[model samples]
Target chain A: MKTYSIVLLLCLLTPYLGNAQENFIFKKAYDLKVLGRVSEDTSHFQRIDSADLQNLPPAVQRYAKFSAGMNVVFKTDSKSIKIHWKLKKMNTLWNMPSVAVNGIDLYGWNGQEWQYISSGRPNSEDNQMIMVENLDGKMRNYRIFLPIYAEVKDLEIGVLEKTTLSPPDTALVPSSKIAIYGSSITQGIAASRPGMAYPSILSRRLDFDFINLGFSGSGKMELPIADLLAKIPAQLYILDCVPNTLPEQVKDRAYPLITRLRMLKPEIPIIMVESVKREISNWNSAMYTRVNGQNDEYRKTFDKLVAEGYQNIYYISTSELMGDDHEATVDGTHLTDLGFMRISKTIERYIKDSIAPLQ
Target chain B: MKTYSIVLLLCLLTPYLGNAQENFIFKKAYDLKVLGRVSEDTSHFQRIDSADLQNLPPAVQRYAKFSAGMNVVFKTDSKSIKIHWKLKKMNTLWNMPSVAVNGIDLYGWNGQEWQYISSGRPNSEDNQMIMVENLDGKMRNYRIFLPIYAEVKDLEIGVLEKTTLSPPDTALVPSSKIAIYGSSITQGIAASRPGMAYPSILSRRLDFDFINLGFSGSGKMELPIADLLAKIPAQLYILDCVPNTLPEQVKDRAYPLITRLRMLKPEIPIIMVESVKREISNWNSAMYTRVNGQNDEYRKTFDKLVAEGYQNIYYISTSELMGDDHEATVDGTHLTDLGFMRISKTIERYIKDSIAPLQ
Candidate 1:
């Protein structure tokens, strides 16, 4: 009877309560458990080490500063979530959506898998938006993926004042990670949001973390990039740079880059991915010949390495990469969220087979 | 011997020839066979009639002017194709890619299916881009889907000089069409490109044209819209406006709209689609309740109409609309290309079964 009266009193006062923002307690996202990063010394949410910028290409250095695949993980019992983030600049790409380039994507762990909650829409450089509201106030695990192609200055998460907000008590993420190195597609150019990138999708499905070393328009299998990648420790490495590299460049550089990486990280596995067929190649004979030539060169290099007895090296072909229908990309070159899902599904099996024994 | 000499001569001169655009004859897109439009009285590419704007809601009138699912069909033997278009104004949505909003999507008839070729990327109000080059100079059928959410002032298509460029002689598109009416998702919001929208996707796969009457934020099942939809002659009609209508609004407005449409277009099939489950509803209590309530109300209205002896009315549940995974949308609300694919595939079977007898 006493509980009934309290419920009745709460129901009566529910109409009078207004402006939920006034009841929130804001916390810096930096204090939370961060994932999808290799280095922790950086003050901001950048993917690459700033100290190594001098050795990298100009485009790589600039692309590295953008938070491509970094995300924050925490558990909260707040009825609502509000996110406020400051981007260094409003860097909206022509082909990609602003939500993917600068906005924040939120996901919640629903016992079985991480389900999408909502997105924080970015209207300006300094933007604040509510992710979700009027929840049941139950303790839930949440991860918020940062901007895919924008430099984040700072971020804060707001929850109800009375609710508890803290890091995970159990092991939600694995200690070892899968590091991917590739071009603009890997950098999440045309994904609807950051979390929809192939690496992020694979991470969520496989319950692992991925260090995305994707440099936009600069994943050309350069020796400097190879040197940098070899230094970052990981369970496996994915090289998807054939799209950006010319056929001659592939034939010239694939051997040196693979040999150097294999020499440095002998115990780890490296999976070489062939570039997916460009959609325009269906009609345009030039793209068809060019892409096929690039893939042929890449395959020959992979076969040569296999012949040389590289034990830990693996190869992933482009047959089932983006499916039979070539409607996976926005432009003929870059993968959309649909393409990302197909690629992630295709690559997930290879990742699982390679990493199981090591894990 | 003569063919071999000609081939050798062409190969020799290939290196010297520069700027392929210089050897092209430009033709206005309006002269070609236009598809996915109901009225051709308008001077430009528009889905809806300007004469009907006074009867629509203010937002609907504004949205109707945009070329959402319109396309031009032409046959060309040119080695390359170039497109130049002028937009009334640049209308780039934050969540949607500009390629989808303002750019053109090209597809080719590859015997069995319409395969993706390339997309013309939009940069500004006046934009010109090369769609493809270096083809085999074979006679090929092509369709270029117009911008999904931008107004086209004028459009021109260019083909190589001394090559045949004309409209399709064969019936590439059927005279009878499938007309769809819905909210922003149906209006092609957040798709990777214009061709990736559900109606456009279905049209290609089903081998039929579709009149897209999707209005952003204005598909409220208004009496005026039903009156307008009833007048358009088509093989079938689809009502997918549950996402934009309130539960009470569905209960109040749905019966009147459906009855009016059925009364006017007595022979055509009317498919009522339930609102797709929003991704945010998985966690947000308010959205969960609201969306479920709206669907329930919509379903109940359909059941009532069925019980009252409506013969040609059909109902489609939200069972497999966007798949089980909630990654189909950029936000929790609007669909991405992945979501559009899922929706199109799910709805295709129902459309095929309904329109088969009529055809």
Candidate 2:
């Protein structure tokens, strides 16, 4: 009985004992929050207000709560950095989430573009933290990409003891808050790491602070969502929710969402994206119909908006967004890392030409 | 004492009393093994004989045991299909082990191309059998792609009770046993799933049986590996080991390996490949130097081989293999799905034109 008790005690105390390095506290990201970290709440996890959240239907509210692309930027002088976070909930089995789903990717701004640094993994007890060691100590600029698919309940960052940590020049990041509302692909699936997601890639490449309003399977452009989105101050609004809605739903909701955005931020660039065509659609005419019809709605809506004297509204057709080759998708729908890169590259030109900076 | 005994008993019994559909037994893969199923061997997990294995050095021998594209072919009539496999060891921390290091993907041959079905995740315990349910009821074909970067101790298939599972048309698969030997990219690192790997994609695209001898960091073209690879009766031998080897290593091993291959199979085609260049190489000139120098070695070896009257030897330059764009890789180094697709398309033409079919 004594032996058994001793074994159980050791098992219980093992995790708490930790490594030689004392775990430091994760400071509040006050600067990044002001720059526009788009979690539902002020912290890292809520989508909308808990009171306002209840008014929506159960499914939409649940989907909205997912913390996709909600990241905080901070600088640390330590050679070792660690990520600490817990899921709102975990799906242990089924679907087999991609590597980037719950992982965090770190990128350093090398004066020009964001270069890859390292990835952090969860500890043995997954909810604890994953640590990365041996970062270059030259006080380089850094970005910690958030989870793509999962809902992060809390996120904290820690560096080695006595290391100086400071906030980066917010000017180094894009001055504009770029709000992109879309579906699963936009939420960033099949990317090997979070930084590889199109939006995340664009954030690094184009130097934009971003709001990923990508709701997997449920990002049909609802009026309530549009109303809520209008409250946030954005320099550019990207509507890419075509893939999740039916042709009829797109016809009804697509224009209203843009109208709402135009009402609040009339001069900002609002780019309406045609659903990226699926690989199977080339052979399957039914799939072709769905893809073509959805894009047709985008063209019609853009024309209607333009006729009404909405000058800043723009449109992107799917002609070459994913490239001519049919190898861009993972499951014929979601973008892989390659697909994400193509999307980022294709979108960069339009963004540069149309946004506030260019205008 | 009684309470302790009861608690222990429950721990053992809980997994068995799992969700209603009891995890069925994995059907034995009678094929894919020349030496009996090594999982049961109580030795290291190897698909080939230990006596022949001693010819290679220790490091390569350990890598050779990983079952990358090694699959067992079978047809089934059940409405559901399940996969059961155990890893020799498990990593229970971050990066989650779902995308690259260890994961399984199922592909079905739909007469023309290989279609993606589903991916399997382990049960609560990482080592337990992974089950995939709800497959088509018709007599269909399947290729269960094994882990790309991990060792598979055991693997088996499971169908619903009393369902018919028979051998597929051997001709429906590629008649030419294509032996491709390369590095981690060939082993499908970051492909989201196993079937999306270049070798696996090409197999489905061309309807060919394949042997993927891609070792992550161990693919140095050693004489022992060439001696062993010559033993297999391959229609075409793809030597893509350049990515892992340096220019000096290539200069030393390139001609000798091809010479060994030419001596064994005089008429068969042998395609030598330049390593797909990294994304960072465009700006980072040092990277450019490495990639350029490596391809130069490939050109040199191919020239030397052809001059010696080794006729069926061919070479693919880096220009078209990974595409001109820098967005094809997951990391700067590893190819993503887009990269894989581009590679397959580029190689397909070479395979058909260089091999007897196009001629």
Candidate 3:
């Protein structure tokens, strides 16, 4: 009689329990854990967020919010995953918001390397919902890449009950990292999804962490942006801003930005890259002049740095960036997903050599 | 005074010329020359078009119109290229209609292989426009891949005025060639655009014309479609239907289709493929069972064929499909553009050797 009475009371309260669960969906949402940047106690989860948006110049301020080549790492064992997020208003003349997976993609580690899991995009507007069901319910490391050409207004990850979640292993997600700064190619102009971008590809293959300071057409190595990057501590600094700069501009700005970074983080390893030659440029005369000039100026800057007795600074030439067959780009300037894969494979050895051994 | 008057009259007629050009956009447009298929004079551009759409089972007919791997090759000296097209309404769960470039991408030969020039997806609805400007003025060979997951109601290509256009060379567009039939992977589920699809990639790399008979989920080696395919003459037959079949279904359907094709065209090379394994399947036991079971049955079919004294039948094992690191997919099953590249690389050697050397 006692057991029957208890069962009757539980059935009577089922509707109230369902209502509680519904309310909790939005009211008690968990913020997705983001690493590879400064602490969030300052209320900053992305590289460029509310605090610094106002400080940027109007020209680059728009790109600053794009969340280009940003990443977040953690570990989770969720049976299913849901992302409640909004796409940023950011867009380019050549790229659309939807083609970039609304600027987010996720991958999970399979005890060895990262494997793609899913991405977030919904056809509906205002409130987009992306739900991934039937995940392998095992303890796996997870990584989420932010949009390359768009910003995330807000994003939260929902997991099933009692799924064990933790931070990434320190070996892979190093406390300090190699920081990369460059133009649209480095910002992942045409990668299919955010994580497939060259920087993210390098991070996955080499097992390291990085901050991509790629700013689409505007990554001209301005001193103001360099000032913000200098504030962060990293083991190596990679400068890839030659593509967006003219020879005259690189002569004026590239060395100064490198100088500023070196002063702030002296004795750190620095790797600078010449602009990747566009495949079409081989035939287009005007393009050939521009590409060849960019390489000449970038090499000049490297020579100047060496002459000044700069130690542990390195350079990667233009020929090494693309294959001899030249099947590495979507447009003449921007990289496709295959371009990113080829570039990461081409430059991995040079990139790895520049890294100082972990203590 | 006469010379001045003539120049003034010429300037006055410029708007009229512009209006004439506008009228010619669709009215005087040239039907894009399609290669790699049997003649459509029998009113069949694909395996089955409007002529026989009524005859196919409702389920298979729904997928037949998607134009899974159809390609058109042409040469033009036009300074600019334009495409006017409408999207076929075939779509998948996660991939949107607009996400797949709505089934079209174009590339130009750069003396060796295909270089991605551009892909088309106009934001506006109905009568989308894709205009590629400032192309090299010299005669350039071009290849346009039709939709992988969608079919077109009608399509036309427009080049700049006074440019020469011609059909592909006979050497490149061979008289007889390979024909491939398979599932959605064979139908290109997640390539960034149609040209990157494996069949198209193989077609370009091997320099051989092919008829791509990949239907989305209906590649169960049904006798009806096989009957239609058997009528077409090809140098080789490639069967990649393992992904869309259960072991029991394979045991029942695969052999009959092969036997039928053999009876129709003897002494042709037939290459069978095992389903490409997914990275997530390593831990998902149910998925592992499905993938492994499919492979076992496929191998069994190959062994049985050899035992029956069938010569020139080849089998491609699954281990070659993905790298040991297993980072070759977009989701657990669908390939990203990189995955497609890795796959095209993995199987190119086998597929190439099967091709009789180009005369």
Considering every candidate listed, which one attains the maximal lDDT? Answer: 1
Residue A161 C-alpha lDDT in model 3: 66
Model 1: residues >4 Å from true position, as ranges? A1-20, B1-21
Better of 1 and 3 by TM-score: 1
Residue-level lDDT of model 3, residues B1-359, one tens digit each, is 56643432332111111112432233112254565453455323344555555655676677766665677677777766666666545444343224354546667877777766655653432344433444568888777777666656666776766777677555556566677887777777766667767877888787566777666655777776666677567777888888767666687777787877877777777888888885545644444665576678888888888999887788888887766555555545656666777777866776667664422
Per-residue CA lDDT of candidate 3, range A115-144, in tens? 665555434323333334445787666777
Candidate 1 local Cα displacement, residue B250, angstroms: 0.6
What CA root-mean-square deviation does each model show from the true structure?
A: 6.0, 10.6, 8.4
Q: Candidate 2, residues A152-216: lDDT per residue as tens digits?
A: 76666777777866777666756667888887777776566667777777877666777777766
Best by TM-score: 1
Residue B222, candidate 3: Cα error in Å is 1.6
The TM-score, computed over Cα atoms with residue i paired to residue i, of candidate 2 is: 0.68
Using all chains and alpha carbons, the TM-scores for the candidates as numbered come to 0.94, 0.68, 0.83
Select the stronger candidate by TM-score from 1 and 2: 1
Tell me the docking grade of candidate 3.
incorrect
* lDDT of the structure predicted as candidate 2: 0.64
Worst 10 residues of 1 chain B by lDDT: B9-18
Evaluated at residue A35, the lDDT of candidate 3 is: 48
